[model samples]
Target: MAWAAWLVLWALWALRGWSCLRCDPGSMQLLQELTGPYLSRQLRGDPGLRERLEALLQRSIEGLAELPIGLPSYMGVIDEKTMGEAAAHFRRAVTRIMENDYKDGQLFNEMMWSLQALRESFTSLMARFQREVFCPNKCGHMVHQFIDCRACRTEIYSCNRGLYCGERRLQVQEDDDLILDCALSWHRASYGAKSYRFYRARGNSEEVMVTSPDAFLLKKEVTANDSGRYRCEMLNTKGWVCSELRFQVTVTPLPGNSTPLPMPPLLGPLTLPPSSHPTPLGGPGDWTVWIIIGSSAGLVLLLIGGCAWLFRRQREVPKEDQDSPGGQLNT
Candidate 1:
């Protein structure tokens, strides 16, 4: 049961990252604890082996997002949602890795779990994940994306198409940030796509995204410079584009001294914030507030005037008038 839950957590985290989670931190801690004990068994003598294994682990985790759940479909036809979607999902992931070019499969084979026994162990863990975690948490048709009680921020993003999350478009104010993901965003794909080039267009000019913090993830705090059309191309082993993901990012200037407009999560990774900027400070529905600030002051002044008028009228009535019936203070 614990291993199954770990599979769900590791896969979800590897795909969505921590931004979408709202649960406790124990999942990661449990994973780290488990990983150390397990790796220690095989990593006792060879000091260099640990480093290589760590790199393999990191790469494998990152690659998990792109590998679709289960193997390729039989035809263009899609399968109905059934009890074994989890198996299909994982089958796709494994098949994608193995089907990739030689280098991709080689890296996977080098991983500690490549051995038949360890591979079966990994498979067993995933099976438990399906029964305990996957089936019970099905919220919608998107089994690969929607995992568990939908523990996400205000939104979620995942791998759906050739790219992890399909296409996207964005228009946000200055100081806003963006994220873009694609097929080549993974470390390994069916094609020997080693790297991707990101490009943005402004009028006739364009700039390639080279120095971004990460190749798979694009964390850019949009400025005036960011406003324009954007595209990312996944190149195959032949150095030609195999897949293309495009976006039109428009960065509007934030008015001086005004609160920067809130930007909700985008369809895909582009919604990622907290690294560039925090996410939404809104609710499920829109709302409006009409504040009347000085109305209370106006009411106080009216009351004071009424009291002053009564006091003046009392003063106007002389003592002699009070003594006379016709000139009574009541008048």
Candidate 2:
């Protein structure tokens, strides 16, 4: 914020004037007696006083040296740390004057009182700056869900994620009636925007029209007619305190009759042999089909070779039996 920088510059100027005033020979002599040897010797003369004051002021400026460029509208650039540090400096000055006494009692009292006032002013300013600038009192966040279907209107639902305004702090309440308001705004680009409230209550006994009286969900499906900014207001039991937030939602209806998405083209027609069905890939000429045929042919050849080898061995065994011994003719 440019205002923060301006405030810091003004503070530096004021501190410079104060330091110069304290550098006067008469004033320094009084401080010499009040603060003792350390402050008098180490922080003597106008230059030394200015240097010490500048060092204190520099602590705050250095803390906020990195300023963001083009910060978002929802975000703030105020430097809270710098303000806190400046407030601390004011408080310390107050303490220094109050802790010691000097020869001129009236002057010492007056200086202490002035420092006290400055300390209080800076402390209050820091708090107010943080509240109004850094932490804005606005509504919380909103989350919306859109359902896709072909109908008269699209189904939409949204919820308020927060209630209070301070940065991330929740505003807690009990037995509160939440009043929701919806307004329609057309022509998103135009500077002239018209908004109309959804339902307004007239009598004390009359109730506001809501999709759900208990929950935050909209009672009816949001149609194209329900496009605009929506704000929710919460009222306490006594109707004394109220909290509110604003959100925008748009609902677009699909055509009554829509064409289906086209299916992907097939590689080729699937065909199979009369005895076997098609493979898992919807075709018989796949790598899996070839692997199955090769394995079956190898098994059939192995079975035939085993049977022929066994038959040849059986015939040779009978002939070997007849050749053995002296033979049947000798018997």
- On TM-score, the candidate that comes out on top is 1
The candidate 2 region of ten consecutive residues with least summed lDDT is 183-192
Put down candidate 2 lDDT per residue, 1-331, tens digits, no spaces. Answer: 2332343355443342122222133433543443444334433543454344445444433332222322232111223343344445554564565455432334334554554566455445545544544324234322222211112122333223345432112221222222333311111211122222223233343233432223243334444444444444443233322344344444454546358887655777766436565446646568767899999999999999999999999999989888877556742
TM-score of 1: 0.27
Per-residue alpha-carbon lDDT of candidate 1 for residues 157-245, written as tens digits (9 for 90 to 100): 22233333345777777887766664432333132324567886767987876523234545567687866677776554456454566
Number of clashing pairs per prediction, in order: 9, 1
- Can you give the TM-score per candidate against the true fold? 0.27, 0.23
Clashing residue pairs found in predicted model 2: 211-219
TM accuracy, model 2: 0.23
- Where does candidate 2 stray beyond 4 Å? 1-91, 105-231, 237-248, 253-258, 261-331
How does candidate 1 score on lDDT? 0.45
Q: What's the true lDDT of residue 312 in model 2?
A: 99
